[model samples]
Target: MATLSNCFQPLKFSPKRHRFNSTSLFTRRCSVSATINQSKLDILLDSVKWDDKGLAVAIAQHVDTGAVLMQGFANRDALASTISSKKATFYSRSRSKLWTKGETSMNYINICDVFLDCDKDSILYLGKPDGPSCHTGSETCYYTSVFDSLHSSQAEGSKLAMTTLQSLEATILQRKAEISESSTAKPSWTRRLLLDNKLLCSKIREEADELCRTLEDSEEAPQTASEMADVLYHAMVLLSVRGVTMEEVLTVLRKRFSRSGIEEKRSRKLEGS
Candidate 1:
């Protein structure tokens, strides 16, 4: 339930001054509390097999969501810097130098833990990114649809795979804002839902009922999945309309992680009473 926003600190930089000369920011290393001992880190670094170009594949994954944020190459210095700074630092193969993620874009990846793959030829960095990982402004490097239809065709016909719920929520919030500002334009389905509370509630109820019905039929697995998607979408729309964020909902869910379902329901009922 932990979000990327909670993990990464926002980077402050002036667009006018540092926009052109952002390379210097990458060169200067920031201080972070080191958890790993120098000796242990040295041994770990030594075990890694750097390729001919003195680089190893570094995969940055979100610690909470288990989503691969981005992948790049890392040298010994890059790995060392990443550990020391508690920020994702990767060796830019194209630039042939060490570059910290979010040095320019201010979308830095806050490091939680770094792991070496079984082969020791690759590294996995568990972290949370401040913003989109890709330069094209997508959440991750993988935005293009390829071979998705092959897998999705087996279930629920063909639907676009939504990997980042946070990103989708952000888009919905933005659309709501745009609709509020626009006078003549037709409001999106999300905006319309936000505008009409009764209609939104009705849609959510309808979707939930459909989802329940879908679950009753074992042969309609794909339809069940589709209905589930509808239920989630409508529920999120309700949250948006109520001025509640997905992150707030996630925070609540995180708090309930230690409690049993019955205990949680009883506790909520007790609080209401």
Candidate 2:
């Protein structure tokens, strides 16, 4: 099992200065060899710093799909337990107990690389999750992320949904290729879209406008999740047809999130105005 935290960030910490009175502190002398061995077990990393509450935050990631599982707080024992079991187990600060991740749903997040912060008080466990890490029945604690593939870990529980999405994405690609090949012999709608840039762009624009124009109606009938899925799928095809990868779209979104409100709006306005 591998962890799939695709992003990384540098950490900075500022701690208050303190003076240690060595004279008042008792020093226990031990054999040089024994001391060295103890040092190994007692080692702390700046990466895994314990927080003020003596708890460390652990983020779990999926390996192949690179989906994030869930975040938890871990005491030493919980960390050790996860390492020992090769599965996620955390200390419940509010419950005052241990929480075995996926215990209820059997969706275990297997650890791969464990990154400690500069202070060695926290950890980042990168790996693939077996099933939904969140108990709320969503793929992630986050309700929405444009990178739907990043929801694989959580969607593992919904075998049907996961399979359908995967198949749909693949099918769309294959269908486009097939349509392109057949279009050379017979100018079909799909072939025309591939050959005529203007037509393709017009169709994509139409789909986008239609998607934006339709609001989910709860009056006569509420919109089913499938309807939204269709809109999103069409949008994805529009991107694919334009030679844009999903990763690129997500990168733009990340930049948008990182920007301040004014900066963000200004950038968008610059593109338009």
What TM-score do all the candidates reach, one by one?
Answer: 0.56, 0.41
Any runs in candidate 1 off by more than 4 Å, and if so which?
A: 1-47, 63-72, 80-85, 91-108, 115-120, 130-167, 216-219, 243-273
Give the CA lDDT, 0 to 100, for residue 15 in model 2.
17
lDDT by residue for model 1 (1-273), tens = 111232122111111111222222221122236466989989988899999988999999865455577889999999999898888999987788899999999888877678898899999987666776778666667544455445555433222223467556656666676775887766467767778898888887887887787656653788777777777777887877777756456435544665588999998899999
Alpha-carbon deviation at 204 in model 2, angstroms: 23
**Candidate 2, backbone clash total:** 22
CA lDDT, candidate 2, residue 196: 60
Name the Cα RMSD for model 1.
11.1
Over 4 Å off in model 2, which ranges? Answer: 1-41, 44-47, 145-273
Of the candidates shown, which would achieve the greatest TM-score relative to the real structure?
A: 1
Top candidate, metric lDDT: 1
